[model samples]
Target: MGKLGGEMKALAKHCGGSHKTVNDCIHIVQRFDHHLLALNVHIQRVAQIKVRHIESYIHERLAQGIGKRTLQNEMASLRAVLQQAGRKQVAEHEWLTNKSLGLAGASRSGTRQAITPEHYHHVLETARMKDPGLAAALELARLMGLRSQEAVQSVQWIWGMGTGVGGMWRRCMGKFDSWLRASSGWSRLPPFTVSERLGGGGKYQAALPSPLQSKPESDRTNVEINERTCPE
Candidate 1:
């Protein structure tokens, strides 16, 4: 760890939360520290952080086109660290309020759009040529409707379990069993638990059809063939 990392780790010991929460807090704070360095403000310790630092960092992020919800999260992390550093009055500063920062209203609506089949396959094929591991991860994300991070973590988890590509495909098929049944006109389907290791806090039951059910048969078949041919 570098000097800043060591300082953050020590500061994290004072933040009361679960291991994951503390790590996440430190991650955001570290990102802010990067912004500080980029702006030529080189404060070495958490205790040295100031309200001016926070203001400058937020302005920099806004100029870089960061969204309001994300800035809100960064501010929350900074506030926690500042409070721990005996700067609790910073939280009451009028200029640091949500309204002053332009983060007070309801969150903007999501702009996510569905990826067309042609576009998805085109990208997947390119990834395969460059890196098979990336291709496998992309395939898993498509079939399981996972976010990119969750897909990569799932792949790592599979490797940790001593199961390679073949095992991953088998697991995918098992999860889709309920969807296949639902598509074949079944009235009911079984529930499956999403593992806590996949980024969420704990296991939860998902009793719906796999997102793959909405996809065409050709897309599903192509993925199956690719997985089978993928090297172990």
Candidate 2:
């Protein structure tokens, strides 16, 4: 391995970086070598790396039909190597931003279309017919807006339910120890209303569900569950 490669491996080890990321960085560094030579610039001095070199590289890659995401990765590689070589200021230059690279909010492939109410119901009915278990998971997402992961993973029936001052309340956990509540109405419904448990250690209160389908809170009191994560 060259000095650049060795330094990169060391940086990855030091920072617990991913092997794939380190490999990508190394590839970018190699490309930069050829690019520097073509531009009649020295590759030896890390301190001599300028914004113009980076900008030129970006344009050259883009001209070759390289994608915004790929360019972004290459830029990240440049920053990593420069930062490791004590050229932190160069890496942090204002000209090196994602926006400057014309990659800010770049349209990505395979974007999902927004789900309509009719489509949602159709999916739910189909899912129910095929797999009740999957249908339950989907229903949790649809009614409560819990993330698919949160609905499937974080839910625990083992914790059991508790009777509160107002009604029966069961505390549920969401992503990152975010507690959700399952109350009386939740149990009565097909899928229990997923409530987010708020506050600190051992103290959690069931948050009131959001108004559903543009209906008033009072109107949907029977099924007062907040919509959280969007179901795919």
lDDT of 1 at 5: 51
> Which residue segments of model 2 deviate by more than 4 Å?
1-16, 108-232
Over the stretch 1-232, how does candidate 1's per-residue lDDT look in tens digits? 3466567666766787755567778887777767777777766776676778778878878889988888887787777777777778885678897778877784678878999999998998999799976886677567655557656665333333334432443344334333211111211122234443444743332222234345565544332322344344
Q: How many residue pairs clash in each candidate?
A: 0, 10
The candidate that wins on TM-score is 1
Estimated TM-score for each candidate: 0.52, 0.42
Task: Give the TM-score (vs. native) of candidate 2.
Answer: 0.42
Query: How would you encode candidate 2's per-residue C-alpha lDDT over 1-232 as one tens digit per residue?
Result: 4443345445544332554456566667777767777777755556666889888988899999998887887787778777777888888888889898787786667666779989988997999799866776776666565557545642343233333312222322222112234421133222233455556754333332322335465544343322232111
In model 1, which range of ten residues has the least summed lDDT? 180-189
